[model samples]
Target: MAMERANLLNMAKLSIKGLIESALSFGRTLDSDYPPLQQFFVVMEHCLKHGLKVKKSFLGFNKSLWGPLELVEKLCPEAAEISASVRDLPGLKTPLGRARAWLRLALMQKRLADYLRLLITRKDLLSDFYENSALMLEEEGAVIVGLLVGLNVIDANLCVKGEDLDSQLTQGDVSVERDTYKQSRQGLDEMYNEVRRQLKEECQLRQDVENELVVQVSMKQEMELAMKLLEKDIHEKQDTLIGLRQQLDEVKAINVEMYQKMQVQTHTHRHIIQQLEMDLKIEREWRQTLQNDLHRERDSVAQLSTEALQINGLKKEFHRLQDENVQLKTICEDQEKALEELGSKLSESKLKIEDIKEANKALQGGQVWLKDKEATHCKLCEKEFSISRRKHHCRNCGEIFCNSCSDNELPLPASPKPVRVCDTCHALLLQRCSSNPT
Candidate 1:
């Protein structure tokens, strides 16, 4: 049973591989302008070859062939549909279908291997079904028998009528036993021949399937090789695409760097140009200032020239003034000598005037002193010649005298013979006269 299961698994795997190979081959042919019918033949060839490979690989599990119909029913239900559809054919419905179905049932029951062997070797009776549609009919009939067995509609004792006959003959009398034996032998032979015919058809159908499977396996291998080649090409193209993309990226980066460098240079150039422009503007202003200073210096020079000319004119006037001053100095010297003489004369005149003034002042002082003395004298004279003393005479002279002078004894002169005399003198004369009086 383990060997049978392993064989089923391997067959399934091969069937799947064949189906895949067929589909791939069909697709390849369709992708081009290849003939459709040719493509179909190629696909069928691939399927047949793959199926044969599966059958050979599973050959050790030949006992599983007894239930090939069961396997077909379970694993390839689509094959069952094809079988059912073909069962309606006139030839397939006749004794051939019934006989094939019975034999498959007996094989699934595993009652007799020799019966199965006899069925597979009978080529003459199987040739009719093989010529009509052996492949389709055999596969379908086997599947039906397997189904019926699984359903318990059939049992391991495939000779159901023979069992009944043996039971009936046992219940009859012993005198007809030899006839029963002969009839039993004939029935077994007939059953064996029919089983042989059906099994031969099944074997032929299996052979045709194996041949088709071989063609399919060959086509499958070729398709697998083509797929490997296509995969390798795709990988190589992908690597080349990646390399080109990397190079493109590097170029873009280089372009970006160059653009940045250019921008920096442009900025630097613009800055330099701006600085030069500023320098030019400053130089222009400086030139204007120098021009203004030059104009001012020219004006100053012109003014200085005018001043020099005026100074020259002033020098000539100064020389003339110096000569005039020298001549005036000479005239001033003569005038100064004359003025000195006049000053000496003026000094003499001043001295004379001073002397006159002094004389006048002295005369005035003398006149004052004289007036003062005359006043004193007049006072004294007035005091002395008082009216009371008048007519006094001197006694000696026998002249009249003041009493005060006469007392002194000095003679007062007689009134001079009209001249007044001191009383004393008068007294003396009187005396002398008296003495000489003869």
Candidate 2:
């Protein structure tokens, strides 16, 4: 049952699509003789017959498509026209013949899909003629009805009255027709879309041009009005200029008389000005001489003031120098006293050195004792002696040195306790004791 519905659905789709394309190509009009139109009717008849229930009547097992198609009139009032017309036909005796005639009339009215769609909605009424699985009673029936919507655009002008409606022509090569139909439909759609786009662009361009032209026209009108106003003002100014030129002529005549009078006065004034210029020249010479004397006096006064300032500055400098000399004399006197005290200490140090040398000769042979003033630097390190660097007497050698050079202590035969000695003297005494075994 499902397979039957599938086949019928596929057939309905191809036939309805190709028929709509060919109808559009033929300017939406088809006659009974057109091959695609005849094939569309045959496919629709097969779809209606598939899964149809058998009705036992006086004629035995009647399964005519006309029964369900007639139910369209009861479902919708608008189908009454096709119903009455089909019934009134002269020679449509068989239900199949009447059904075929009715389809043509309904298609001409452009309501074949509408009438069938209404009949399919009422399954209870359709059950009398079709089985539960009939294409008319299932979803396939509703789909085929929907595909008929495209056929509404076509005006099918069929005169089936004189023709035989009971017999139908077999379908032709629908697959090839379907492919050709697709290519043509695609090209037509593309051409229509391009034309619609170009038309829209042209409309926009025309609207822009019209708006610009309107603005230009309005500007031209404004310039014309302004030009007229400027010309009117120029005429008024030209009329006033004529009167101004007449008045100028009168003023020129009065100026000529005044120029003659000024000429006479100019000569008399020229002689008086010459005499006054001579007097001014003498006055200017005398004034220049007086200015020279004033300048010389001012220079003399400035020279005297400068000399006085110089003398005052020199006097201040001399007083400052005298005060500095007095202070320097006092410092010199203090330095002289310090030098005398150093001389006395030097003499006392010489006497002590003479006594120490005598004692060194009385004892074992030894080097001469160094006086305090004679040893200005340490003998070992050669550092200059200052007040902080005091002299030290070496017990073994009796030589004067800084405390740092004579810091070592060692026991000596002359002293019980350890005595300070120079680093050289300490080493010499230790070597002597180690060798002599006394």
How high is the CA lDDT of each candidate model? 0.45, 0.79
RMSD of each: 47.5, 36.1
| Candidate 1 similarity to native, TM-score | 0.15
Candidate closest to the true structure, highest TM-score: 2
What tens digits encode model 2's per-residue C-alpha lDDT throughout 1-438? Answer: 997787667666767887888778888567887877776776777788887788788988877888888888888888888889888898778888888898888888988889888988898888877778888888888889988999878887888772377544324445544544564456556656997999999999999989988998999899899889989988988888888887787788778887888888898789889989999999899888778766866786798699789989989998998999899889989898887978977788677656545654455474577778888889899988654567887877778889889999987556669989999877776775565432
Please list all clashing residue pairs in model 2, or write none if there are none: none
Instruction: State the lDDT at 305 in candidate 1.
Output: 100
Full-model lDDT, candidate 2? 0.79
